[model samples]
Target: MYLNSTSPTPESCEAVYPDLASAIRCVREQWCELHGYTEPFCRNGVWWVFPPNGVIPVCIRDVMNSDKGQWVRIGRVSVAILPDGSFAIAPKSTSDRTD
Candidate 1:
């Protein structure tokens, strides 16, 4: 899942895959297939492609169109696309702080 943001970071943000880690892993293996590194990652059981765009599974536009300032959680990790065009993800077990 993704979310819209207005915080001064990338124009959008990233997230998700329902047990798609292997798929992501496949993408990661082929980073060169895209313009640059895919920046694939897994937090808790949730997989994500950060700075997403035409290269990855999702893009900034996806976040830009989502509910702003909302957090999208997958398992123990969560993705929160801010209201200032910035986005972040953190473990649900940790502090809510995004420093």
Candidate 2:
């Protein structure tokens, strides 16, 4: 599967995956790298958070039914599961922007 990201430079955002397992692994690795963490505390196998301390529970809207990818904020991080099955991760700034 060719999982792509939404950005001006699509070529740089694109990734190839031979299988779903490998794709999931890549997502986890990329997310960890983005946060500069050797390991991150993942919640419910979907949401990931760092530090692993005093994390208040937050409700996140289900994005499974959306045809297009939807960015959902979970505390300090934002997560989006794309239609092509790629996961997008970004830190939520104070301005509440995903970019």
RMSD of 2: 12.5
Instruction: Report the Cα RMSD per candidate.
Output: 12.0, 12.5
At residue 83, candidate 2 shows an lDDT of 29
- The C-alpha stretches of model 1 lying farther than 4 A from their native spots are 1-24, 31-37, 52-99
TM-score of 2: 0.34
For model 2, state the Cα shift of residue 85 in Å: 7.4
Candidate 1's clash total is 9
How much is 78 displaced in model 1, in angstroms?
A: 33
lDDT of each: 0.39, 0.41
Q: Model 2 over residues 5-56: C-alpha lDDT tens digits?
A: 5432222434545555555555545544543434434465554334224354
- Per-residue lDDT for 1-99 in model 1, tens only? 222234422323244434334333432334323434355455554444555355545342343333344443345454454322244343354476566
